[model samples]
Target: MSLEAPVVRGVELADDRTPRPVTASETVYEGLIWDVRRDTVDLGSGTVRRDFVEHTGAVAIVAVRDTPGVEGASQVALIRQYRHPIGATEWEIPAGLLDKEGEPPLAAAQRELAEEVDLTARTWNVLADFHPSPGAMSEAIRVYLARDLAEVAEADRHTREAEEAEMTAAWVDLDEAFAAVLAGRIGNATAVIGILAARGAKEAGWVTLRDPDAPWPAHPAHR
Candidate 1:
């Protein structure tokens, strides 16, 4: 017996923003960066109560530069920062929360790149966007592919504090970073997603990327 591929049907491969009715909602706990919210949602079949993190969304950067003397290869900046929740220092790309009021995603990404890594990029493109954990959090993240890099001037650099004060940075080959993700050496969700997506975009001749200012309708804050 032989089986054929299943018939494909859809307008396009994209996620829809369908919000369920919330009968009741309240903040269960408010933290520094996010809050836990409990809501009674009408699921059509039945109503269910659930608690999830109310995030402000964030942005990440895959700052890449051509490897000197290497053909068709690049190096991406990675930072090591201690995460209290995980109790471990993980390798991550420069990223930050969108806590500032009325900040665009691209602007946030640029700010994070400079603050976290002391670098700037002349070219930027949207590599990918995703919800880190849609089931338990409303944290939407947009990762950008940043190239044509340069260091931020000393006088203009922002002062670091807390975990960022002790953070360390390294420039690694893009392929090596992707391998680290596959090998589980790198566990930061945003880092893993950004590296893999950057590699995929590069493989596709960077045509798969969107403009840096592309509309992001899936972000909770944006919606």
Candidate 2:
């Protein structure tokens, strides 16, 4: 393998220097999403090794809802839930990881929307697709913007995992979501990037980014 580092955003990294490689390692992690493999890389010189990182592909759905307000009919959606990693509950847009094999990104988004909120979208716009952390994980988060909204016929949602606990969905204001993003309340990367991009498209009055090979770049059907 080439000893080159992937350039992202602005930084260009140097190649790693590992003296010796290990011959064996073990699975060091088991999580709700991904399993971690601790590998022994042969470093060519002596006996020193670093753990190699791997991950299952993950997707983050950026769900937005349409609201009819006097101030230009801005669209937004509710986002919250306990993130065990961060340990504090924050209100934002609905999003989750499709941390399973053979799962489609759009399908995961649709499911997450139905479960988190009781709504569905007739139109969908692909906002962005990128890795949240590329250094150690290979998660490609595909973010989409749902539009031309309609509610699902039967809202299948749950507050309890197996009916042991009660949970609820909260209403998220569109303006507030945007403002929260600006104020740094909305820390979810997909939500922030997708909403800001959508807003930028509206302000620019044109398509800012789209599928390069798509015939109808601005059309939602291209998503």
Candidate 3:
């Protein structure tokens, strides 16, 4: 199906489920990373106050390459980095926040690819986009498929520090990565979703893959 159909269909479906207007809202806390806000929603029959996190969305990349060893095998770039919230150095695809004002999602992906792994890709496509958690946060992540990779010069590499200082990058077989996701060894939301999505897309011959700069309505800043 054409990509526009999904967009239009979503809007049409939304017309029937539109929620009551927000009569009032206030920021309870403002921080460097995210903000907490209370929204007074009118539910027609009643009204309620709910607190949620206001966040800037993020992006991830599934950087893949063809390896000569196996007939149907492929390799993907993954990073092992410490996540403070989880208190673990989980394996994940290269990803970063979309915090820059007016920056296109594709550009943020490109910048993240170069900054995280010091690599660049000649080809890029939208692999998958999803909300990690919708109940309490307004964040989402768009994953991209990046191929034809090349390493950047040492002098131009992004310097690492803090949590990223101990990070390690590796090239793992795509099948192994997906297996890890199924086995629950890799718990990072983006990595698990992106790996499985990439496998499915590859099986389907990537026919449904969208352009790197595809429209993402879930990302409020992008719209």
Alpha-carbon runs more than 4 Å astray in model 3: 1-20
Write the residue-wise lDDT of candidate 1 on 16-127 in tens digits.
6889999999999999878999999999999999999998899999999999999999999999999998799999999999989999889999999999999999999999
**What is the C-alpha lDDT profile of model 2 across 154-178, one tens digit per residue?**
6354444632133355555556667
| TM-scores for all predictions | 0.94, 0.66, 0.89
Candidate 3 C-alpha lDDT tens digits along 1-223: 7766644444434323345799999999998889999999998889999999998999999999987677777888999998888788899999999989988989999999999999999999999888898779889899999998999899999998888888899999999999999999999999999999999998898897998888887776664
lDDT of 2: 0.59
- RMSD in angstroms, candidate 1? 2.5
lDDT of each: 0.92, 0.59, 0.89
User: Best candidate per lDDT, number?
Assistant: 1
Candidate 1: where are CA atoms >4 Å away? 1-11
Q: State in Å the error of residue 92, model 3.
A: 0.7
Candidate 3's TM-score: 0.89
Error of 1 at 138 (Å): 0.7
